[model samples]
Target: MNKPQIRAHGLLDLLRLVAAWLFYSSTIFFHGSYLSPLLVHGYPEAGSLAIYGYMGVNLFFLISGFVIAWSAEGRNWTEFAAARFARLYPGFLVCMTASFVVQTLAANPTLPYDPSTWAANLFIVAPAFNRPFVDGVYWSIVLEIVFYGWVAIALFFGVFSRWKLQLGAAWLLMSVLNESVVHSTALQMVFITQYAPYFAGGIIAQHIVAKGSSTEALLLLAAAFLLSCKEVTAGADWMQAHFGFSPPLSSLLAANVIVYALFGGALLLRRRIAPTPLVLVLGGLTYPLYLLHQKIGTLWLNALSPAVGRWVALAIVLTALLSASFVISFFIEKPIRKPLISLLLPRLNMMASKLRLDRPA
Candidate 1:
């Protein structure tokens, strides 16, 4: 049996940290309404800047699709599912539990509600029923699960069995359909749009490997850097007012997909840089940080606005939450993830071996 190696782009992780920090700080600075004892007004430019930074989540999804598809290449569906679930669920469950407990304490107590809502959150399927969001971040996980199901179906049909063309087309079509017809930016983004391009990008990178071209990786890395800085709505004051392209799905997708592809390439190219253990640790902490940031921001913004000033308070809170998230990921989340995976993997491997062995021999 071949032992598996864990791979991720440390540089991308660094970029994610920057964006996460920027987004929270900028959002609080920009939105006075979010600040407790709120100022009635916010700087419009700051608001727009914060919104632009929110595109980072799309980049995250793309990177996820690329990495999972790249690493799980030629692996069985069970293995793929196990790997994704193990990486995503443990940290997510902990965060979800924390959010529910917090929300219950914070929210109005007069409303009648069922305990099953928390149960649904545990399964990560509460979004399907239009349940009230437990945390702002949980919605993204629901969408990610939908994306995973789509990947599983593609794998089931032996899509990756050939070269990556059919897989690319399938993802592309899903993206186009989501963007043009389904017309739900939130749904498309969460369910498929953002991930498709990243998966395709990774497939392209993998193809370059098969063809023995090193420049392919370099080009992708450069593209990622360029795309990350692309402000999709830059100088859109007149256009935002006159054109009325509310929500800006096409523009957002354009920026996000490019960024995702670029980062996907950078991650693939990291073999040359030889990332340090600390970089790897930061990369591992990203998911927990992603989950906790917004809720922490919301609470801090609400609690500290009058005392510390909105923007100043936001920066302080974001820093503390990020530090806490790192601790949680390293100590609590990582520990749980390793043991769960260890316990489950052997059973999965045995099952896979049996299925493959029973096929012929």
Candidate 2:
């Protein structure tokens, strides 16, 4: 129950959001030819440089673990679920719809809209439904949902608070074994074994804030870093194999290490972080910006590049995305959320309560 006192500037959250935009945006830079003029003839460097941005996603997972664990305190499963849904789904639905529209309308569309795929993306499980995401970012949102599911299950079992450290530690170790020994798709899906170390680091961060000495946090942080390093190495291998750029494995590891260190250091210095209403607005824009950026932003880049120069076109698109995200956050998403929460939450609470009651003594 010892969460931050709701200050003005979430230094860490802002940091995570920036990393998300930087890394993911860079990936788009390489994967597509939006900035072809800026790249060398073969675009070799772009691929390797963009690979490091993948760590930004891991940074997000770590932050989510910490924030979710901190937020879940002093709430029943109903409250937790409702809060998460209200915060995530309303904004997501708005952005996803916008993304669908923009991508569908683009002159040379990247993902041709299949009605089934768009519908599946509405549930954030396009692949499971044998369809594709309208936007690629939905994959990470799916992981966050899976993590939330496990956390909810833990809450229901009444083990989250009492056994968090042990649970997190075991999850980290399982990730190691899962990668090396089994390579089971089922295990990966169920536990999110690939990203568990980051989540585990988040949980351990909460423990550091709430209970443990800095030394303990440091030790657990070391374990998570070592495990996460393996994933980074694998990513390097994958990038080399598929993308044809062998970014020095050492550079990739160093970049990932810096990301982990920044996150851990933020936890240690979390007190200095101020939380303002602006934090919510910045946080709000991040998701919408992320959702709308890839397909549409690139379209904008392509469309405007002929008229304007490439870098100028890129700037225009970035500005447009930021403006669009702000509009979605304040005008559409925030307005829709209250009504949505009001309509669905009571029913959700009743169902969760019934489930809680039905549990055998």
Candidate 3:
């Protein structure tokens, strides 16, 4: 394979970060005012410009798949899992803790903390098991975990080696049936279709990287899809009507694909663009912004909306979110990432060695 060509997608990732901030800020702005035109009841955009952010999450998953495959190509699956846990869990736990603390302080007197419920969030499994949307953004994290677990399982069963195409094909079929399966039992119906593409796209992108493919055209297409795609309104009745198949499934699939493509395109761009310190720094802050902003936004909306104009409140919240996310990313997230991985990797290796020795194989 030829040396991978670096593109300008890093810059695009930074731009996406800025876009997410604007979307979220708009959500807060619109939601705070009953008269705000953007606030349509039941539409996700009613709360924030998260229709865009949802695509961004798809991009994140694709990036994860691409980066993980590229980074851990020949490594043990356990190490990859550990790396992901270290990358995501610590920040998640911290943010969840902060959310609970704020909730305890700010909620109506009648609202009480349920330790059992809180315990579920600490493990990041609550959202997966039909639990309430704690901190709102946690649902995506749960999905991310599910995606990772499926990938790990695929790797374990040697499905990845024997039939990569078959794996994707199977997932696509399940995704097609996702809506129907939801009726039987949402718990057992793990349709891999909705998510497999993002990861698969990442894997494909990695191959492109390895082959030194030019990504300019692909990147442009992704940008167009991301910016121009239709958004689902907060309380869309279209899904309720169900036109033969679920429109929810169609829309969800579309949204996920658009986002995945955008990220794949971004990867090509990341290498082509000149490295800039500021852009890189902002891009790095995305995870913390993602993890912390929901709680921060909720708290800010509750505490500050009364005193300031809706627009002004929105500005303040956006500023605080970006500022705090950067602080956490640089000071907390970045620092701990390396040490946590370093600490965990050795213990995992030791356990793996012990298990190997204990077993005949």
Best by TM-score: 2
Misplaced by over 4 Å in model 1 are 1-47, 108-114, 154-158, 181-195, 206-272, 346-361
Q: Give the TM-score comparing model 2 with the true structure, all chains together.
A: 0.88
With a 3 Å backbone cut-off (N, CA, C), the pairs that clash in candidate 2 are 7-275, 7-276, 8-275, 8-276, 9-274, 9-275, 9-276
Model 1 clashing residue pairs (backbone): none
The true-versus-predicted C-alpha distance at residue 274 of model 3, in Å, is 2.6
Tens digits of per-residue lDDT, candidate 3, 1-361, equal: 1133133244444545644554454444333333223222222335423333345555655566566555444445566667788878877777677767766666623224567657778788774544554576676677777777776666555455345444544554454355235533453235434454555556545545554544642453343233223223211344345322223545665655555455555555664655577877877667767776655565665566577754566678778877877777778777898788889877866886787621110
What's the ranking of the predictions by lDDT, best on top? Answer: 2, 1, 3
**Candidate with the larger TM-score of 2 and 3:** 2
Give per-residue CA lDDT, model 1, range 8-123, as digits (tens).
34445554554454444544543343232323334344543444454565555555554555555666666566767787887888777776666567572321235676777778
lDDT of 2 by residue, 1-361 (tens): 2335242126555655656666666666654532343222223436546556567788888888888887677666656777788878877888888888776776334575867767888898888888788877788999999999888878777778878877888898899899989999999988999998888888888777766666656687789888888888888778677757667878888888888777767666666665466765777687788778876776676677777776788678788988998998889887877787677768877786776632211
CA displacement after TM-score superposition, residue 195 of candidate 2 (Å): 1.0
Regions of model 3 farther than 4 Å from truth: 1-56, 108-114, 127-133, 156-166, 179-192, 211-261, 356-361
Residue 284 displacement (Å), model 1: 2.7
lDDT of 1 at 248: 59
TM-score for each of the candidates: 0.72, 0.88, 0.71
User: Worst ten-residue run, lDDT, model 3?
Assistant: 227-236
Q: Say what the RMSD of model 3 is.
A: 6.6
- Among all windows of 10 consecutive residues in model 2, the one with the lowest summed lDDT is 34-43
Ranking by TM-score: 2, 1, 3
